[model samples]
Structures are given as C-alpha cells and as structure tokens.
Target: MGYVPITPFRRTAEAVCVQRARVQSAPAPLPVVSKWDILSELTEARAAFGLSDRDISVLRALVSFHPGTDLGADPAKLVVFPSNASICTRLNGMPDSTMRRHLAALVASGLITRRDSPNGKRYMRRSRGTATAFGFDLSPLPRRFAEIAEAAEAQRSLQEEIAALRETLSLMRRDLLGLLESLPEECQDAALTLSEDTRRLLRRKAGLPELRQREAELSMALTHVPPAEVISTEEMSTNAAEYEQHYQSLKKESSDSEDDPSWYPMQSDIPGSENALAKKKAEAIPPRIALRTVMSACPSLNDYAEGPIRSWSDLVRTAEGLRPMMGICRASWEETKRHMGQIEAAIVMAAMLERFEEIKSPGAYMRGLSQKAARNGFSAMPMVLALLRREGTAQYSPGRAA
Candidate 1:
C-alpha cells in the first residue's frame, strides 16, 4: 500500500485493510468462486455497473494469469502483478494506453483495486514472515459476487417482462388492425384516427414506456368503439337470410353438422344456439383450400391427427383434439365457432397450432379473431397464407388459394 494516490475512494483501501485483518483472524478459510462464472455475471450486469467490453477484456487477461479458474485461499495470489506488455500481448496486441484506460474503468467499477508499490510499480516485497503483492487486486470480485449475481438476475427478469409486454401489445395491435379493416369505409371516426396514430407509431420502433402508453390508449379506444352502422329491416332480413342459407349449406355438407353434440357452439341441437350464433353474424367466407396446402404450411398439426387430414371434417376433428392442448377452454372455443363458422374455426385452430410458441394466450387470441369475424366475416385464408409465408412455403399465393 506504499505511494497510494489520493482519490474520492481513498478510504476504500483503508476499509479493505480492516476487512483483510478480520479475514485473516477468521476460523475458516475464505470460500473460492469460479472467476469465469463471475465474469459472465458481470457481463450481463455490465450496463448497471457502467463497464465496457474493453474493461471486461482487461479483466479477462488479468484473470488468465492466475494459477487456475478459481480465486483460491491464498489472499496474496489474488493480486495479479503482470506487466503492461504481458497484458497487451494477451489482449491480441492492444495498445498500452488503451489497456491502462480500461484498467482504470475496472477499478472505478469496483471490480478491481489498484495496489501500487513505492515509485508506482507493481511487485511483491518479502519480509521476515509475511509477503505484500502490489498490483491489480481482484479480491473485490469474490467479495461482491452476490451483488453482481443479483444485478444479473434483475436484468434477466426485466428482459423477460419486456418480451411478454411486447408480445401482448403486438397481439392487441393485430386485433385492432383487423377491426379497423372491418369498419364501414363511409364511417370516419376516432377509432379510425386511433388506428392511423397506432400505425404511425408502429412505423418507428418505440421504447417500453411508449409501448405501455399506446397499449392503454388502444384498450380505452376499443372499449368505447361505436357500432359499425345501423342496419335497416330490409338489410337485416337479407343478412339473416344469408346466415340461414349458409347454415343450411353447412348442414347439407355434413348431415350432423348442426346437430353434432361435439360442435358445442354450433350445437343447433341445443335450444336457441342458433340465435346466439346468428346475432351480429356477418356471412363468413370459408377458405376452400386443400389439406395438402395447409399441411405443407403447418406440419405440426399432423402430429395431433391420427391419420392424414384428407377433408374439412377431418381438419375440424383434428383441430378439436388439438384445441385443449393449447390451453384454450371449451367455452372460448365454442364461442369462436359461434361467432365465425365451423370450418373457419377449424382453420384458425390449425393456424394457432402452427404458431403455438409465439402466441401466449391461444383462447384470448381466438376470441379476438372471433370478434372481428362477427363484425364482418373473418377470412381464414389470410391467416393461413401468412403462416405459409413465415414457414417459407411460398408455392400457394392468394390468387391460387382462391
């Protein structure tokens, strides 16, 4: 501790001396920790500590000169007395000035401490029964391991929370976009303005605070959304007739389509199920796409199906089996089928299975798609094609899918 320089933390060395005296008088030897493991934790928590890569690199080179990976029982051994040239060589020919600057950064971050000898040199002096090594001391690393680990863990949790929020916001944005598209063009309103603002905001990447604010604004806007337009009696009767005609056609396709107990939402077998399904039901346009086309896009669904999904009913059956596995409850699935048609529901289920990992709440997601379908008809082809594009199976375009 000879020729020590005066600094803001000059008392730090005094405190270290007191701690060392206590450590020397302890009943047991100090526990050793892996230097590399500490280095990795510090890497994650570097931003918190205001450390740079070059600072970490200097630390790395210093640690490598130690006998082994662990900072062991010998306290004096922790003081690495490497010359600047030796460290510079280890750092892939870094300039001496740059290395010195990074070393200062490490010292400022409390990851290391300077133990300069008389005349500002780094060396050890052997006395009668004791030795003193003057150099860069990494004893702080082992002492502050817990602090570094906590910082790293906090950073990790923050990243996870941000990721979850981003996904939630993205899902909400997609739903609002679909809803905006469903709105009547003649009706210009706040929802339209909000959608425009949302789109503009999305054009540039936003930070976490901005995202949170936008999410709240979008949620409030959605809650107060006005009805698309009021339908006259003639228009209502015409839409109702179309709904009935489509129901009849679906019934004709499979004799048990309406009566099937398995089809809970479309359970025309139950009294008044038709009224629940028919209310606000714009005519749903089913994507008459082939199973091979769907399978090529979503091969994961094949795992749930016992045999090949050769027909639309097979897809419905397969989707019914696959639905519960995705944490989607029966009631939500039933309502989705009620809002949209059965075939469209099955197609959505297939698309959901394809994107299982990315989607956090399959049930809520399906419900949003259902709401959009109820306002205007939901088309499954767009969802399917989007998935196909993501999977890089570009053979089937929108033109050919029709």
Candidate 2:
C-alpha cells in the first residue's frame, strides 16, 4: 500500500450487523420511489417512529448525497458515498460527533443502513469488468414506505380528534359557567368529575383515547345539569330592555306599591323561553304577598338583621347588607335587584340564607336565577313557597290580601 491515513474507529453495533444480514438475506422487494416523497412522509410521522429533529436532518443530508431522487433502483446496491465532513456541511456545520450520533440513530431505526468497506471507509470498487458501491443504503426506506405513510395518516387523524374534542370541552365550559347556578344541588359529583378531567387536558398533552374518555365523562356529567337552555340574542336583548324599564319605573315611583306594574312584570311582559318545557305561560303574580309570609318562610332574617325587619325597604336594606356575607358579588346582587325588583331579590336572598348551609355558592345561585329571569318569568314566590313547605308553615294563599 502506498499510504493509508489514520482514521477514527467505531465498533459495529450488533443490531446493525443483524440488519445488514437481514437486508442481504431477504431485502423487502419494493418498487422505485421518490426519495423526497419518502422523506416527507418520514418527517410527518417522525415522532411515531421514535425519531428526533437532528436524526431527520442527518438522514436528509444522507439522502441528498444519493445519486438520484429515486431509491430502490437495486435493493442490494449501495446508495451514497459522501464523507462525514461533506454530510456535516450539508447539515449546516453540525459537529462530527452529533452527525455520527444521529447517523447511528437512523440506522437503529432501520430507515437507513451503514455499508462499511473492508477498512471501515465508504467507497466504490471495480474489479476487471464488475463494479460495486458502498456507503448508506436507502433501500430500507422505500421498503417501509407504506408503514411510515400509515403512521403519518394516523397521526394526522389523532391531531384532528384532539382539536375537535378541545372545541367540545370549550363549549361545555361555557355551558357550565352559564348554568352554574341553575344545576340542581345534586349534580356536584358530576361537576367535580368534569372539573378534574378538564383540568388534566389543560395541564398535559393527553392522547386521543384519553381525550375521548374525558369527553364521555363530561357528557355524562352534563346530563345531571338541567337541559340546555338556549337563549337567543334577541331574547336576551329584549329582556335587558325590559329590565331597564323596571329600573326606570322604580326610580319614578315615590314608594313601593303592589299596584305598580314595575314591581310585578305582567305575564305578557315576560315571554316564555325557547325550550318547549319552559314555554308554558307564566301565571300572574299575586298583587300582594305579605311581609309576614316572607318572615315565616325565612326565620334566618332575625340573625342577619340588626333590628326588627318590618317593611319591604327594611328587608331590602338588610338583604343588601347580608349580600357580601353570603359571598354574593356586587354584579350578581345588582343584576338580581334590577331583574327581579328589590323585594323579590331580597326574598330570594332570605330564602337562600335560610338554606345557606345547604347551598354551596350563593353568588352562582343568584346568577343562575338572574339568567332564568332573562329567558322567562322567574318569581321569588316559588322559592319562598318551597321554604314554607319545608318549615310546615301555613301556605300563603296568593288570593289573600296584603
């Protein structure tokens, strides 16, 4: 030999040795394929194939060194013969150590194979009338094209499912917020389960199965919540205007009186909700319900009030003071006052206070009712009457005098 330059040595991995034997013994006969197209599919499904960005980059550089764009011209034939330095240059000056590491990764993944020469160098040889090539064979790539493409398509479908589930969860979250108060007190277990599932999605990259399971659980939880109340924009706007009128009429009145139309919105002033079940015509509110009845229905007033709770004004004042204590926010309290009129809002509060131990969140309770008032005619009489039945007190006949 004239001269042989010193070169770095690398131990042949047993896995690589096994792969080389497999390729020689029974290479998966495959049709010639576009190298770039195979690379594109590999890139899309890299994660599923246990490939990293650097690994793909090294493979890309190796593919570039191949003689043509197509692979599998001859399954047993060698592919590229570029040196380490040349491949590194194509990879934007990646260090030799990094290139070698990623090259090993590609080999282990079976996307490419190493074809080392007798002296561990990559080159071609010619003997008399025959020629042989050796470097990194890309035949393995086209052989596994169908597998890789299938993985890519599956990944795409998984991503789509995740996006769709996220949208559904988002809508459910909005519904939960709107119906927070309206749900029956018994729905806590379902709500809690849904909360935990949603929290997981927010915190991690949950898989498709995980997401679908959560969605199913949330759907079941939602079943416990009241029927979906779809309030239209026009209806909400009309309700808002009607509330404004109630406030104006209250402002115009010198004193609270049952005769005032503002105090009790007529059956016609309130429209039925969109739900057929909620479409039943609302009965006219009694012109006069006694302060004594409210007191009998809610005895807790003695605890929250400083002095004797006498008039509707005194009840309103006491309820206002107790609003903060019950954890009801200003916005909720004000909306309730405006929508239901001061006396009704006050009675609702007193009823809630008596059952405060049973009620979890008073603020949400007030908001749920306020939302109901917008969609339909919500009256405090029902709430008060429910309490009277619980207390075993004589029912306040709506036809009786003030």
Candidate 3:
C-alpha cells in the first residue's frame, strides 16, 4: 500500500484549510447558485471590508476558472487549480509577483483558501476516473453569501444617506448666502463666518454627523435673526405730515416772504405741466440712503451696476441699465418715471432688486408698482424706512442733499 504525502502549511494557512474542510463537510443543504451572483455580492461588500480594486480583480479571475457557471451544482467541485500564467492572462496580463500578492490578500481576507498538492504544484489528482482539485478552494464564498449581501445593502444605504445630506447642505448654503446679503452689517458678518465654515465642511466632504451639526448651528443662527417689519399706512401719513412741517419751518427760516418769486415757483408758472411737478418732487424726495447702505439692503442690484455705486447717481445709472434687461419697455419705464419721478423710480427699482427671488417677473412687478404710484397709493418713503429697519438703523435720516 502507498502512503499519501502530507502538504506542509503555515499556521494561518492550516487554520483556513481546516475551516474550509469543516464548511465542506457540513450537512447543510446546498442551493442552486451561480458564480456571478457570488462575485456580485463580494464586489458590493468589498468597500465595507476595505478590499481594494486589485483584490476584487484577482477574485474575478479566480471565479472564472470554475468548469461551470453554477456554483452549487456540486459543492465538492468548488475548488479551482488555475496556474499563475492562466490567472495573469485572465487579469489583463498582471505580473506574476503582483498576482501572488493579490492571491495572498484573498487568502488573508478568508474569501479563498489554498489547497496545495504535496509538491506545491496546482493540479487535480485522478483516482478511479474521479478528479479532485488541489489549489484555490472557493467554498468560503457560498458560506458567506448571506453576510456579504447584508454588508452590501448596509453600504448602499450609507451612500444614499450621504447623498441626501449633500443635497440639503447645498440648499442651506444658497439660503445662507442670500440671507447674509440681506442682513444688517453686524449680523451679515456673523452669518458670513458661519457660511465660510459651512463651505469648508462641504469642500472636505465631511460625514453626515459633522454636516448635520453644522446645519443645525446655521439653522439656529437664522432663528435668532429678527423678522423685517412692514411700515403701516398710518406711519407713512404721520411721516409725510412731519416732513411737510419741517420743510415749511426750514423755508420760513430762509425767507420772510412765502410769495418770493425766486424762493417758491407758482403752480400757474408751469400749469398742467407734469414734468415740472415731477422735477420738483424728485428734488424734494431727498437723496436716498447711501449707495453702500442701499446695496447692502438690495445686493442683487450690484449685479447690474457697471462699477461700484459710490453715489446715488451710480445707483440710478445701474437701475437704468437694468431697466431694459428686466424687460421693462421704454414706455413702461417712462410711465413709472412720470408717476413716481426719477428718485422714487430708482428707489423702487432698488427695492424690487432686493425682492428679486420672490418676484418671478420683474417687468410685471414694476408695472404693478407704477400703477399704485399713479393712484397715489405707493410711496418710496415706506420702502426706504422698512429697509432702514432691517439694517437696525434707529435714526431714519434722509440722504445728504445733492
């Protein structure tokens, strides 16, 4: 009788061989399955176990060596004995040294086990017309199929959650930017700092917990912002009366005669002349709040400005430049000018610019405001005062005289 030679083994390799033997001898029922199904599950679960692309590629080459596509057709025949040359050919001509390293990785990962022959050569032994493979055993793959599928599902869920977080972060960034532009200087600076922090987190591709924390911080900051207050009709009437009284007092101080030809122009001097009255109204309307202040209140207007609006004239020119762009025809713009006068028209344009996101159609909105002005129902004073309130400016002084 001839004695069978025992193959020498390292401790880890021996342990893996023992485990594969145990799995192979188990009485558990084997179901019909395909090699591609096992490979697909392994690929999806690879990220969870920190497996590299090269490791997966090597596994793919090993899977291709099975005689048939079905993995469960014969559990005992799950072993493959492909040579290094064959594996390299299947792996797009991988070098022998690199193939050995990846093969070792597959063994270490417990996905496959080496079933070496006595002489360390990979081959099948035939006895009584039955062949037994002696090389890489793929039995562990079927044993771990359920676990791999679960891990793959878990990884997919995590990726979906990350995608949702990223989308929410993008919207939060846009809202924060718009809010910062509208906020008072002190508040804007604080919000700007928060925005920068958010941007940094986004750039780094921070995890869900860190991104959610930053989003909560930003939402909390937004909650602390005071809501803008609308100016009432009664307040406007009172302000108009006070302004008229102040104008009268200033006129009295400057001249004793109310009928002075040079001091006050008579209505008869320019009877039924809307342009003269419009000019007088424009001159009396007071310089609007500073260009810097107005731009802060209506940052969208800056996009239309050809240069920095250092003065009210620059703002007017920018508004004029935007008039055609906003689809406000010349006739409509002239009508707005006729009703509201130049200064008030510019101020209305600035206010419209501030609410650009809310108003879908700029031209239509301007036309609506123009109609209100024609009916004596619209006043730039309230809009300006509301903006001043938003800026947290307590004193509502008119702009400097031109």
Candidate 4:
C-alpha cells in the first residue's frame, strides 16, 4: 500500500477539524433527506449558529453541486467536489477572495468539512461508476438536522411572542392617548408623564415584561380618576331642548342687528341666564373655526385620516376611524353620540385625539365626557378655544368676522 500525501490551501483550524471529525464519526441516526430540506432548517436557525447571510448563501451554492436531491444512503457520497470556479459562478460572480473567506466560514461553523486532494484541487475520481471524491462534504447537515429543526421552531415561537407583545403595546398607547385627551387639565400632567415613559419604552423596542409593567402603571392611573357624573335620559332631553332654544334666541337676536353688543349678554346683564349664556357661547363658535384649531393643535390626527381633511365632515370621518383604536368601546361611543349628537361627539374625539398624549385611559375619559354631555355640561367649545389660546393667537376671534 502506498501513502497518498494531501496539502490544503490554508491551514485548517483545530477546533473546526475536531468538530468535523466528531460529526463524521457520529452514526447517521437521521434519515437521508433532500438537501433543500436541510438548507431550509439552516436558514431559520442561522442566527443561533452565528451564521451571516453570506455564509448561508455560500452553503446554498455547496448544496447545489450535490448530484442527487437526497444526500445518498452512503455517508461517503455526501462529498461534493465542485471546483472553486463553479462555486464563484453559482454565487453570482462573487470575487474569488470573498468566496474563499465565506467557504472558510462554512468550514469553521462546522456546517461543512474540507476534503483536500494532494494538489488542493477539487475533483472526483470514478472507480467502477462510483465516486471516490475529495472536496466539501455536507454530512454534518444530516447529523445536525434534529438540532437545527428544534432551534428553528424555538426562533419561530419567539418571533410570534414578540409580534403579540407589539400589538398589545399599540393598543395600550392608543387607549392612553384617548384617556389623556378626555381628562381635565388639572389631572393631565401625570398622564403626560406616563405617556413620555411609554414612548421611551417603545423607542427602545422594549420586551414583553417592560410593556406589561407600563400597562399596569397606566391601568393604576385610570383607577384613580374620579368617576363621571351620570344623568337620566329625561334630564338630557330637557337640557338639549333648553340649549337649542337658547341658541335660537341668540341667533335671532344676532341677525336682527349685526352691531348688537348684546349678542352674548354678560352674566351681570342677564342674572338668570348665566347657564344659558355659557351654553350659547359653547355652541356659538363656527364648526370651521373649531376644525381649524383642532387640526393645527392635534396634527397627529392627520396620520389617522385616509385623505386630506379639507372639511369638518372629513375630520369627523377620521375621528370615527380612530375611535376604536383609542379603546373606546362601541357601547360607550354610541352613548356619547346619543347624548352629544354625532358632530359634537366627533369634535370631542378629535380633541381627545389631539390631547391623547396627556390622557391615561381614553375609554374611561370618553365615558366621563358622555355622562357630562348627558347633563348638557360637556362643551367642546371651551376645550377647542383653550387649545387655540395656548397657541398665543386665535384663528378666529369670537364676536368678530374673519
């Protein structure tokens, strides 16, 4: 017997050689499956093995050279003797230097083993129609198939959990914003602080534990809010009629004379009409002014709209779409519409959307507002005007034509 000498292009790492020997010596307990199947598993679990995209791409080229779809029953046939030229061509004209580095990476990762011939050239010798080859062997793929599949499944499960956590966080943010808008200014500072904290977590790509912690904090804040006062249906109707009558009286008085200073009589001028005056003032602002002020103050609302909000009707539609995202239950939303009318409810939703960052619980805040609207005490005019005043200039001054 003659001793055959072989030399490698580069010195093999001892750790890689050890791993390759271990894998090759291990019995094939797994079935001989298609190379594609093993590649799929490798791609999924690549991150766990510290494999990069280029490494996997090189592995894919190695698999393509296999004569059969299934790595043959004989372990020795797992070797593929494709020339470096063929590998570079399969890798989409990859540079020779780059191909060598990635091939070395594959060997170091223990996914493949080098079988260097005497001249370090890759080729197969046939003896009686059987390949006696020296090149890259893919036997490790079958040996590690079970481990790869398990790792892939775990990775998939983790991805699903992360996706679910993200969805929950989104709902929490929406609800918090809705609640913030509905809260009175006195209670808003705390909600705003919470909003900022939640935003920081989101920016950091927080995990489930952090998100849950923030959600619990927000829930606690909501529990401490004072309950909204409730009113019966009969009282709501009476108040609505009174409000309508007052508005009609003011409209008649204004149309009679444009220069009348008494269009909105002061509380001192009409002792018994204080509540009536407030109601009239609340409804007197034109919808256009309210819409412009809301659009300017709460520009975030435009993100929820499908098109440009060119009219009050468009603003209402955008608010309707955002209602559910804010965690306002259908029943509570309907109750608000019944008490305040659709336009009024929509206006309130826009304002809430505007101040959503400052509210703790949108659903609860909306419910509170609904209860007040049922008593004819909820007025969007004050809220809109307040936001406009905060801008240091009103878009339209009251009792003056633009």
C-alpha RMSD between model 4 and the true structure: 14.1
Q: What's the CA error at residue 352 for candidate 4, in Å?
A: 14
Residue-level error in angstroms, candidate 3, position 300: 21
Candidate 1 positional error at 225, Å: 3.8
Taking all chains together, each candidate's TM-score versus the true structure is 0.49, 0.53, 0.53, 0.53
Q: Once model 3 is optimally superposed onto the true structure by TM-score, how far is the C-alpha of residue 95 displaced, in angstroms?
A: 2.2
Q: Write the per-residue lDDT of candidate 1 for residues 315-384, one digit (tens) a residue.
A: 8899989877887778767777777767778887887787677665565566666666778866665565
Q: Per-residue CA lDDT of candidate 2, range 1-402, in tens?
A: 112222113654575467454654363567788889988988889988799988998898888877676787755454577899999999999999999999988877878766666677888787886666667767778888899999999877777767666666656644443343346656743563455346446445667787777778777766665556544546534443442333344343323232333333334434453432232312122213467667866888878788998878789899999988887767677666555666778888898888777655566566667656767747665465445434332222222211
lDDT of each: 0.65, 0.65, 0.65, 0.65
Error of 4 at 149 (Å): 0.8
Ten residues in sequence with the least summed lDDT for candidate 3: 393-402
Q: Compute the lDDT for candidate 3.
A: 0.65
Which 10-residue window in model 4 sums to the lowest lDDT?
393-402
- Model 3 clashing residue pairs (backbone): none
lDDT of 3 by residue, 1-402 (tens): 022222234434366556655555456666666779888877878977668889999999998988788876787688898899999999989999999898888876777766767668888888887787778878778777787889989867876777666656556654554444345656765665565566556555467788679778878767654576323446544653432333333432332332333323345426458766655666476542444445655667877788878877787788898887765666667667766776678877887666555555565456556666767645664454444333332221122110
